[model samples]
Target: MHDPEHGDGTSLADRPHRRRAVDNQRRSAASADQVHRAMVAVRERTPTGWHAAARQHIDGALHAFEVEPVSGCIDAVACLIPPRCGFCGWRVQVGTYRIGFAVYRDGGARVASFATAGDALGAAIRAVGKEIAGTAHR
Candidate 1:
């Protein structure tokens, strides 16, 4: 007997299973695309170099060697050192400089020079948070 619904001799019982399999494949593809977009967004928002390093140190991903208040420089100054590597230490110096605040990494690599130290610190913190959150999403 011909099954009008299926047209062919294929069992009615098999139709639902095939439909489900097709649906699952579509859903999986959509999920993968969403993940790729999220990763791209995170990459675009996150900063690189010493800013990133400083963020990692603040987030506890890298060990902090020292974070201390300084004198004879700016109104408010703080120096941070990441853990030593052999004999070399990575440092982040944030302080008021000239007309604004300046954040410098080791060897005078400037992460950013902003109107306020708060702005610089906020930028670093936001970058680190985005990185950590992005990994979690992945």
Candidate 2:
């Protein structure tokens, strides 16, 4: 005779499964709307001078990175948004100067400056997405 329950009183199947992509390390959890908007920002392709073949290869890989299970990052775009701030490790702020917006990383060092908040945030999002995409493939 044998017991289905382990000595610890819990079975292996009783453990809660978690998505590796959205684990607490990825900012607790993001709402579906938040994830969708972030996906739009992540999927945007910035113009680059690459051969068509290379671009196609990269695009396919990116598509896989954005698919179900992972769905890319929930909020890879970090910004002190007017409504709410996205937490993506990187820090961002809309500045008060001739330059409108900027991103910061590694302890207050400025990453970039943009004429518009949207541009700054988009660039940051694209960068984060690119990094995640690269890791997802390799």
Candidate 3:
């Protein structure tokens, strides 16, 4: 069969398909650059003094890389807490229908729970910065 309507002779190589923005190597480099930029921005925007601490804590355990289903994913994080308090670690309640992050300060008595660990950390950074700068009341 000639199959003129099928465009069989129209050349299969010209078939429509999504064109890549950049070549594989360039695309990979661009992606990596974007991730690094995001990480740096997040780190920088985080209050002030806490930037160093947060970077130290998250850089080691966090894999700021791309995933199949989710283009970019920040999977798993580690924080280096002071040895003064022995309560620094992943916290879990025995009988609670809640899940999120729990932050404790001043001998682990004052606890603050957040919907997500990122939020908790962000709040901590901002709180500390504000307290130090004396602009917290505002």
Local distance difference test, each candidate: 0.38, 0.35, 0.34
The alpha-carbon deviation from the true structure for residue 5 of candidate 3, after best TM-score superposition, in angstroms, is 72
Cα lDDT tens digits for candidate 1, 1-138: 345554666566877766666665564554344334333333443344322212223321333212222222213333332223232323334433323233444487455443322333344444334444544575
Between the candidate structures 1 and 3, which one is better when assessed by lDDT? Answer: 1
Q: Which candidate number would show the highest lDDT if scored against the true structure?
A: 1
Instruction: Give per-residue CA lDDT, model 2, range 46-93, as digits (tens).
Output: 233211111112321211112111343332323322122333332344
| TM-scores for candidates 1 onward, in order | 0.27, 0.26, 0.24
RMSD per candidate (Å) reads: 19.7, 14.1, 17.1
Sort by TM-score, best first: what order? 1, 2, 3
Error of model 3, residue 125, in angstroms: 2.1
Model 2 misses residue 88 by how many Å?
22
Model 1 stretches astray by more than 4 angstroms: 1-9, 45-138
What's the lDDT for residue 41 in model 3? 45
Q: Which candidate is the best by TM-score?
A: 1
